[model samples]
Target chain A: MNSVVRYFTDIYKGVTSLWTGMKVTGKYFISPGEIVTEQYPENRATLKMEDRFKGEVIMPHDENNQHKCTGCGICEVNCPNGSIEIITKKVPNEQGKMVRAIDKHIYHLSMCTFCELCIKTCPFDAITWGQDFEHAVFDRTRLTRVLNRPGSSLKKKEVKS
Target chain B: MNEEAVKKVILKEDEDYIINMGPQHPSTHGVLRLEVCLNGETVKHMTPHIGYIHRGMEKMAEFNTYKQLIHLTDRMDYLSAHINNEAVCLAVENALEVEVPERVQYIRAILDELSRVASHHLWWSAFGMDLGALTTFFYGMRDREKVLAIFEESFGSRLLHSFNTPGGLMHDVHPNFRKHTREFVKYFRKKLPDYKNLLTDNIIFHNRTKGIGVMDKEMAINYGITGPSGRGSGFSCDVRKVAPYGVYDKVVFREILYPEGDSFARYKVRVDEMQESLNILEQLVDDMPEEGGYTAKMKPVIKLPEGEYFQRVEAARGEFGVFIVSKGEKYPYRIKFRSPSFSNLFVLGPLAKGGIIADLVAICGSLDLVIPDIDR
Candidate 1:
């Protein structure tokens, strides 16, 4: 008689547990506002990324077409994956002394882990993370970017030091 | 009972067969292949093959600086990325004898719990999908996105945020960090009961999980299993409780345990742990220090003394330990990661034996093995 009572108790507990589970789902099903999925592509225009988002590396050029990079190559050395390469050449300064100048600040987007080491290690604050994330390209060569703008030169103040 | 009769029986048993479950199957989570031997529907044995996604992280660590290696740890257990980064940072901090600020400790502890909730949410959804309850997948992902959004608001990456440096955080918490965390805590408290109603109390879930893949306390200890998987067997291996680090000692939370040692018990432990994590988060967020520095001052380049250092943290999955040997160099001489999934994966073979093949899936899901963590 005791065994029979225990068996029925177990069945009653199991059934109630399941019913409670269904109730939660049922509640969500009736509420259309509770749906959390976003419609991709359609919502692209309104989509916003955080201010601190690390999308890609870019060298910020001032209005005078001058950059902060000194071709010191600290970022190149600090990059764990060899993603940044600084091409430097000797240029005549205002004092007629030959000084190092950046020719090309090449950045390979494929190899970069976005660890922010390059930006953090830059003494001159030459490079920073750009907010643009749409970098999809058909060819692999397109992923390699020259950060220095065409006809741009190093900031004279930075070279004076 | 004669030798001839036994020989005939052996010949008839040759119908038993073998099958390979995955290197690509969704049920295996990541790239893990299980070689299973079966007699009709019942599983006789299982051999797991790992390393499909191994990127030689430990070997790669030798060539990178201590700061650069933090990024590599994130790839090991991608779900527990913050905790993995924390383990390495803690090891380095201890080696250098650096004291992090009070605010850093509080923020790190809060983020650790948030990552735990996110990871367990993913596991719960995947577990439900493994059992043919597809709706749970959508529900779990929907809730998980809230946590990811919080991560994105601060650290700027949803999955792999290398946000911790050796001394402290890479950056301070966002202005809205406290407000958003409070909102999430309030929001999730209302939703957690739904999780219990939807999965924990479901009769079909109970029928499938209860008494299946039973592992006792002795076997769990012998196998060196830690985290919720071991706690399910009543082994009491919560690293946070045993050896508290960060603000773990300061906060109040329970180490969830269940003695049944079955699939249901393992599932219950994680579900209960999610609540405990919420409790911890609430306490830390409410009493966070008003003002402090996010990072401590350090030399541009870090070099540890000539010795060995080991630090362990309770990751979302289990105990994650980092062993560093430094010969007073900028780069570690040798680094070895003690990942929890490797030991937990070994228990699958024992648990799955004598159970039906379907039960094998349930058992593997309960263990919640992250393959890259095992491979690392």
Candidate 2:
């Protein structure tokens, strides 16, 4: 008699459990407000990425077309994957002295891991993260960007004696 | 005898056949191939072939600096990327003997719990899909996206955020970090019951899972199966409780355990653990310091003293250990990662020996094996 009683109790528990599960799903199914999926490409026009998003590194050029980069090559040295490369050449300064100046600052977007190490280690505060993230390119060579513009020069600062 | 008779005779002689499940099957999760020898639908034995996704992470770690290596750890257990990053950071911090600030510790603990919850959410979705509950995939991902959004708000990247550095975090939390976390916690607390109702209470799920893949306590310990899987078998291997790191010692959360040692028990352990993680997050988030330094001051170049160091942290999957052998250089002499999924994958053969092919799937789902972590 006890065995039969236990059997019915077990069946009741199983049936109730399944019913409870269905009720939860049913609630969600009826209420479309709970739906969380975003329609991609449709919302692209208004989609906003966070300010902290590390999309790509870019050197900010001022009105004078001069940047803070002193061509120290710190960012190139700090990049783990050798993503950044700086080409330097000797240029005549105001005192007719030959000093190292950046010819070209090449950045390979494909090799970069968005680690922010380059920006963090840059003593000149030359490079900062750009907000634009749509970086898909048809040709692989397009990913390699020359950051410094033509005729751009390093910013002039008063030398301390 | 014709070809049919000959084949029948050959089959009769052995009475068993072999089959390959995947290096690419959807159910296998990530590139794990299993060779199963079967006797009339019953799995006799199984051999798991890993290393398909192995990128020689340890070998690569030897060439990279300690700080650079943190990015590579993100790829191993991508689900628990933050925790894996924390392990390397803790290991380096211990070697340097730099005391991490209290704010950093609390923040790390909170983020660790958030990562745990997100990982379990993905596992739950995938596990339900494995068991033929297709809607669970949608439900699980829906909830997981909320957590990932919170991660993106502060850490910038959603999945592989190498936010944790050697001494502390890469940057301080965002202004909305606390508000977003509080909102997620509140939202998830209500949705958690819905998860319980949908899967936990379902008789079909119970029928598929309960008493299917039983691993006893001794066997679990012997195989070094830590995390929820080991706790399901009644082995007390919660690293957070046994060897507390960061602010784990300050939090009050139960280490969920079950003696059943079956697939359902393992499933139950993870479900209960999600709640505990929420509790831990709540405690730390409420008491977090408003103003403090995010990272400790360190030398530009980090060179560990010549010695060996190992640090273990409870990742969502299991205990992830980072072993480093330093020779007082920027790069380590040798580095190895003791990934939990590798050890956990081995026990599948033993657990599925006498079970059917369907049972094998159930067992694998319960184990929650992340193939890259195994491969690494």
Estimate the TM-score of every prediction.
0.94, 0.93
Candidate 1 lDDT at A71 equals 93
Give lDDT for model 1. 0.91
A1-161 per-residue lDDT for model 2 (tens digits): 99999899889988899788778778877875765777977989988899888888899999999998888899988888899999999999999999999999999999998888888788988999887888988999999999999999989986999
Model 2 misplaced regions, further than 4 Å: A1-18, A158-161, B1-15
Q: What is the interface RMSD of candidate 1, in Å?
A: 1.5
TM-score of chain B of 2: 0.96
The DockQ assigned to candidate 2 is: 0.67
Docking class of 2: medium
lDDT of 1 by residue, B64-147 (tens): 999999999998898999999999999999999999998999999999999999999999999999998887898888889999
**lDDT against the true structure, each candidate:** 0.91, 0.91
Q: What is the lDDT of residue B274 in candidate 2?
A: 92
User: Model 1 over residues A27-146: C-alpha lDDT tens digits?
Assistant: 777875665777978989998889888899999999999999899999999899999988999999989999889999999999999888899899999998888888999999999999
Off by over 4 Å in 1: A1-18, A158-161, B1-15
**Candidates, DockQ:** 0.68, 0.67
The sequence of per-residue lDDT tens digits that candidate 2 reaches over residues B1-376 is 9978996654433556888999998788989999888988999878888889889989988888888889999989999999999999999999999998899998899899999999999999999999999878988999999999999889788999989999898889998999989998999998998888889888889889999999999999999999999999999999999999988888788999999999999999999999999998899999999877998988888999999999999999899999999999999999999999999999999999999999999999999999989987
lDDT of 1 at B225: 91
